[model samples]
Target: MHTRNVVSGVLLGIGVATFVDETVFHQLLHWHHFYDRSTTAMGLVSDGILHAASMVATVAALFLYADLRRRRAFAPRLWWGGLLAGAGGFQLYDGTVQHKVFRLHQIRYDVHLAPYDWAWNVVAVLLLAAGIVLLVRGRR
Candidate 1:
């Protein structure tokens, strides 16, 4: 039940995923920018925007989680399910829509993308499946 808890977890999950993407691929690995069809300055700006948004989401989610805990209405199972689902959903969308459909950016550039694409999507699906299973179990 506890819809608020689930929402909080989902937001946190999205924030975490975005943070990881920005830090690992964009920063550490020097992968493509959020918008690759632009100058380096523009790409950096886009990354900054994405980072800000993710931070906002993380802070908001944490505040909501704190409130739920204070109220003693936190639902652990549902929250976990929501977290996994949110992360998986975001990843899947990024892998498919952002990469393929919109051509915003790819997992990696100047490389054969089939394996990376498959791995990314497969992981997303697994996460989503685990979340669904948890949600169903939590319902009972």
Candidate 2:
């Protein structure tokens, strides 16, 4: 597969993961918002912005994928590796950078953040490791 396809797939995966996280945790479960200090209206606005960004990223990825397909430059192993890496990287960033550093929001309110952080990072590490392995294999 072409490098472009791999990159595009990774971007698509990241976009999908972001949307899923927003939908499931932010909207469905009402766990947290982009900015915890803000009002409900602000939170809703943040969500809308996040959704728009995700859509843009996903659309770009789709366009890249389509272009690569037209060129017949596609690699399944690389695509899968990229997907895993992107999803894991986004998850890690959200859990650490956004949640911990930026203090955007915890996994949930009235709960200790340690356990959630630990679980989230652990899973992210696993995903990253799997992606690395796939990437190595794909290079062979």
Number of the top lDDT candidate: 1
**Candidate 1 deviant stretches above 4 angstroms:** none
Residue-level lDDT of model 2, residues 25-137, one tens digit each, is 89999998777778989988988898888899899889988887788877778887888888888888988999889888788899877888899888887877787788788
Best prediction by TM-score: 1
Q: lDDT value for candidate 2?
A: 0.84
What is the Cα-based lDDT of residue 94 in candidate 1? Answer: 90
Name the lDDT value of residue 50 in candidate 1. 92
What do the candidate models score in CA lDDT, each in turn? 0.88, 0.84
Candidate 2, residue 121: the lDDT equals 85
> RMSD per prediction, one decimal?
1.0, 1.3
Score residue 9 of candidate 2 by CA lDDT: 70
